[model samples]
Structure formats: C-alpha cells, structure tokens
Target: MTNERSLSQKWADFRATKAQLFWTGIGCAVATMVVGFTWGGWTTGGSAQLAAAQAGTTARQELAAAICVDRFNAGGDATAQLATLREMSTWERGKFIAGGGWVAMPEMMGKTDVAATSCAAQLVATPAPQAASTAAP
Candidate 1:
C-alpha cells in the first residue's frame, strides 16, 4: 500500500542519480587528460622555466666564489676565509664582495672552486713577531 508506493518512488530517484553520476565520472576523466597534457606534457612551458631557474642559480654561485676570492686577497688565512665565505648567506656574501673585493667573476662556473683554491694556495704561513730578540748579549 503506501509502503510499497514509497519504495517505488525512492527507486526512481536513484535511477536519475545513477545517470548523473556516470556523466560526472566521464567529465572528470576528460578533465584529467586535459590537465595531464597541459602542464605535465613534455612540450609544456614548465621545462623551459626550470632550465632558466637552474642557470640563474649557477650564475649566482659563481659570483659568490669570485667574491670569496676578492675577500680572500684582502687578507686572512685562506682556509679560514673559505670557511667563513661558505657560512655566509647569499645576501651577506654579496654584501661582503660589494664591501671590498674587486676580483672579476670567471667565465665558467667551475672556475669558482679553483679560484678559491688558488687564493688559499697563495697564503704563506708565517710565524708571529717575537716580542723579545733571541740574540745573546
């Protein structure tokens, strides 16, 4: 009677919902493909942007090494200078170079390591000045 009628009405509502669900699932699949090919695709602009960012990072590191070299020549134990430079923030390193060193950045990025090593190589270990002369009276 009324119970049977309500059960039929509920089944009808479920039927309409099933059709809507099928269409929604298809739409979601199509959208997934579109996005996969848009940004994740090989031909997309993302790779070029990544390469540009990497190149910029490399340039900055080389500049930092050159500045480290300049600061090195200004004076200090080479080993100590290199350690100090590496510890500095990128902004602080830039300030350090701008504050004093005039050495030029090398054309190639790999040259920075060598420049730091060379600066350290030139350091001559000398003994401190003795306050008293060691000559016999």
Candidate 2:
C-alpha cells in the first residue's frame, strides 16, 4: 500500500512540472518568433527594383566611358574634349554618347557657348577618317 501511495505522489509531481514545462515552451517559441520578425529584413519591399536601377546606372556609366575612349582615340584635342565631358550632366552625357558621341561643334550647349562645346569637343579629338579603309588589305 505504501508503494502505491508513493507512485501516486510522483505522478502528481510530474503533472505539475509538465504544466510548467509546456507553458515555458510556448513562451520560448513566442519570444523567438518575435525576435526573428523584428530583426529580420522580411518586411522590406522593392529590393528588386532598387537592384535594377543600380545595374542600369552601372551600364550607362560603362557606355559613357566607351564614348570617352572613342573621342580620345580620334586624335582630336584631348584637353577640350575632356573639359566638355566634365561639364555635361548625366542626362546630357547619356544623350551625347547615344548620339554617336558629342559632335565636334554644336551650335550651342544650354545657350552658354555658341556651339555645343561638349558635343563638338569630342569630334575635334577623334582622328580623321582615312581613305582606303577596308576590312582586308
């Protein structure tokens, strides 16, 4: 009889501990979820768009550099072409490069210079097209 009594007492003790353990586990789970949501960047938006914009900007920069190189290789006045490139805005630079690089002498740039100095400068810098140019000799 005493052994049976002891077994029942142990069972009661385990029940109490189990209740506490269950509640503790619930609390831990809730806490972990709250921390994860708060600290994690799961709520952000438009990351893809931001990345695309960055990539586009980089591509435009590379194109602009190619345009500058073309101008320098033309055997024109490097100093003047460089000055015009520095003075142009990003939009202007893009346009100029897209338009086969700045023309050697535009009528004006923003009404400041008589000819579009930036556009014309590149033309002056590049080498003259030679005759007898062909794919093969």
Candidate 3:
C-alpha cells in the first residue's frame, strides 16, 4: 500500500484531539458568557424590559408632580394652603394634595397616589414667602 493517508484515516487518527478541541471550545464559550454577564453589564431581555418600565413610571410621576406644583402655586390662597400643608403630619400631606385636585392631570388619573406624594414633597421643600408687616421704627 502507498504511504498516503486518506481524509477519513487522518480524521480517525486525531479522534482524541478532536474531542479535546471540542470540549475546550465549549469551556471557552461558557467562561465567556459567565464573565460577560457577571461583569460586563450585559442585561437580558427581561431585565431590560423591567428597567424600561420602571424608568417610564418614574418619568411619568415626575411630570405629574411638576404639573401639580404649578397648579398649586397658581391658586389664590397658595400661601395659606402652603402654611396649612406644612403644619400637617408627613403622612397626611399626600392626601391633602390629592384633595386639592392638584394631581388631577389627565395622565395622572389612576397614578395620582405617587404623583401626589411627590407633589407634597416638592411643596414642602420650597419655602413660602413671608408676608410683609408694617412697623414703627
């Protein structure tokens, strides 16, 4: 017989090496996936969707809070209302804001609870202007 080896014979001769290469490739793939997910900030589709939903909710709440603040400040008795709101306990502030109809925007119908709470926080954080009093020097 001639001293030449056919493709099938060569393949058969390297069967052990072939298996080793295959296993090595599999291990490398698994390692890359593990590293990428653990430290590369790679997010799955489900996690990305959840994050997007949460961001949307936060944006909506902030927008509604802004509108609520504007409406509240535009009222004729804003100073008096602000004083009253500041006197109430923290837990009652949201209810007071909601009752004032400041969080009644079209986009805030069912989501008024969170918006009202945010509005109350913004209102509380802002200092109301003091009334000027006349006094004799």
Candidate 4:
C-alpha cells in the first residue's frame, strides 16, 4: 500500500507539470501574435503619413507651377517669370511635382481657366522697379 500511494503521487505531479507547460506555450503564442499586430499597425501608419505628406507637397508645387506659367503668358519679362519659378524652390517644388507625377492626383492632372487668367494678369503687370526705371529713362 505504501508503494502504490507513492506511484499515485508521482502520476499527479507529472500531470500538473504537463498542464503548466501547456499554459506556458499558450502564453508565448499570444505574445508573438500581439507583437506581430503591433508591428503591422506601425508600418501601416507610417506609410499613410508619408503618402499624405507627399500629396501636400505635390499640391503646393502644382500651384506654384501654375502661377509661374501664368506669369510667363501675360507678357511679363522673362526675368520675373524665372524669379517666380526660382521662388518655388523654397517649397521643394521638384519633389512635390515628382510625387504628384507618381501618384497622378486629380488636381495635378487638370487645369482651370481661372488659374490661367490670374497667372496671365500677375505676369503681365510691370514689376514696380521696372516701372520706375522705365519712367526714369
């Protein structure tokens, strides 16, 4: 009877050990899944932010290019038109335009008559210095 009782105790201990191991494995699996989900969320968020930033940049560049083109069409001197184009550099125009080119945004793809007329007016108006100089001469 003593030997039989000892064997039963051993069996109970072995069963307890197995249960503990099973729970431990489940915990590890849960941890791995959480980590994977967190990583995926972070990557997706970063990509979305990057895309938005690129879109903004492109819009600004398109606006600037439209202005510059309008100025050129209005009979403004080449120098002023060039100056306007150069001013666009502060907004990183090249990168902005390039981004738009890649994404093909609707705003970048279409043109309006209003913008053309405004640019023409802006470009044709004599720059203040040029007007003064011409008056002086």
Candidate 5:
C-alpha cells in the first residue's frame, strides 16, 4: 500500500514536467513549419497546383498570341489592318482582334481574351514592313 502511494505521488509530481515537454514539442513543430514555409521555399500542395495552372494558362495564351500574329501578318491587307488596329484605343484593340477572328485557333477556342490583348499589343508594337521601291536607286 505504501509503495502504491509513493508511485502515485511520483506521477503527480512529474505531471507538470510532462505537460511542459508536450507543449514545447508543439511549439517547436509550429515554429519549424513557419520558418520552412516563409524562408525555405516550401509550398503546400494547393499552392503548387495553383502555380502550375497559372503557368499553363500563360503558356497557352502566349502560343495563341504568336499564332494570331502570324495569321495577321499573313493576310493580304496586313498593312491596312495594322493601320486600323493602331487607330483604335488601347482598350478597344483586344476586342478588335477578337472580332477579326485572329485568335480562333482550335485549341484556343474559348480562351481568346488574353490572347487577343497580347496579340494586339504585339501587332501595334511591330512596325509594318516597307514596300520595295520599283525604281532602282
């Protein structure tokens, strides 16, 4: 009976130390996570997935814009179209390109908005090719 009582007393005395150790472990785990995520470049699964999706969207838009530029330049009246495109306001250029069906690639069917805007910017920035003079200098 006495031994049992002593064992119980020892357990009671050690309870505070046990609780402190548990809390310390929890705090260490939280701190490690914070440091890892903030400075160690650790990303959660959802964040990685979101980043991948954004990258794919950006790549698709870029490809569509490139194809749109090629199609625009291949047209018979590219100079005239470029003149008209330049005359429009910046905000209207995207809609103009979309309406012209420059971004109608099969893979880019429903995703023309970003591609149109990018194509318009590229077209406006690029200078039209000069026509060769027939008269020899």
Candidate 6:
C-alpha cells in the first residue's frame, strides 16, 4: 500500500512538470510572434525600395529606347541606335531592352506604351536643322 501511495505522488509531480513546460513553450511562442510582427517593417520597406528601384530603371531604359526610336524614325537609320544598344553589356542590354529581359525579375512588372505615341508625335513635329541645311546646299 505504501509503494502505491508513493507511485501516485510521483505521477502527480510528473504531470505538474509537464503542464508547466507546456505553458512555458506556449509563452515563448507568443512572445516571438509579437516581436516578429512589431519589428518586421524593414521587410516591407525593403520590398518597396526594391520595387521603386526597378521601376526607375525601367523608366530610364524605356525613355532611352524611345529617344533612339525617335532618331531612327527621323532619318530611317537605326544602325547607330542598334549598335549603341547592342554595345551595352549583355546584362545591361537585358535590363534595358524589352525582350532582352528585365521583366522576369520579381521586382520588375510589365511595360506600357503610355507615352510612346505622344512622344513620337512631338518628335515628328520638330525636325532636325541638319537635314534642312543639307538640302539647302
């Protein structure tokens, strides 16, 4: 009978220890989650910065291409423009050109022709003086 009594007390103590450990684990998990949520703004900011950087790069590249295409359309010679674009390192060309591909990057979205036509029209309206000078001679 005494042995049975001692065995029961041991079981009770073991159960208490298990319960305490379980609650401790739960508390630690909750604390970690709170800290994660409170201090995780850097991730969001980093993503936004990365997105802005990609957009800026795309805008600059698109603008350059538009200017080149403008020059090409003006005189019907894209050789210089193509050469210039091609001379860029493969990585730069890929980053700047449409199909050469910066689009696949997670930070880069798609392209739009939002300003292309208007810009082309403006370029067409204003012709270079060199052509007129050559014709005069």
| TM-score for each of the candidates | 0.30, 0.31, 0.82, 0.28, 0.79, 0.29
User: Top model by TM-score, which number?
Assistant: 3
Task: Report lDDT (Cα) of residue 97, candidate 3.
Answer: 96
Query: For model 4, how does the per-residue alpha-carbon lDDT over 34-79 read when each residue is reduced to its tens digit?
Result: 8877874535688889989988865665575565554344544556
Q: What is the lDDT of residue 58 in candidate 1?
A: 70
| Per-residue C-alpha lDDT of model 2 across residues 1-137, encoded as one tens digit per residue | 36455777887776457889999999999988788668854443587678887787555544444454565556466555455656776446545543543323232233322123333444445565455767775
Candidate number with the higher lDDT (1 or 3) = 3
Candidate number that wins on TM-score, 3 or 6: 3
On lDDT, the stronger of 1 and 6 is: 1
Residues 53-98 of candidate 3 have per-residue lDDT tens digits of: 9999999999989999999999999999999999999999999999
For model 6, residues 8-113, the per-residue Cα lDDT tens digits are 7887776457889999999999988778768854346778899898898768646654664554455444444345554565444433434432123333245323
Model 1, 73-110: lDDT tens digits are: 56656456555656665445544443444333555433
Name the runs in model 2 displaced over 4 angstroms: 1-19, 40-78, 98-137
TM accuracy, model 4: 0.28
Local error of candidate 3 at residue 85 (angstroms): 0.4
Clashing pairs in 4: 70-119
Model 2: weakest 10-residue lDDT segment is 107-116
For candidate 2, the per-residue lDDT at 124 reads 45
RMSD to the true structure for each prediction, in A, is 10.1, 11.3, 7.2, 11.9, 7.8, 14.0
TM-score of 1: 0.30
Global lDDT scores for all candidate models: 0.55, 0.53, 0.92, 0.52, 0.92, 0.51
Off by over 4 Å in 5: 1-21
Quote the lDDT for 7 in model 3: 96
Error of 3 at 34 (Å): 1.0
Model with the higher TM-score, candidate 2 or 3: 3
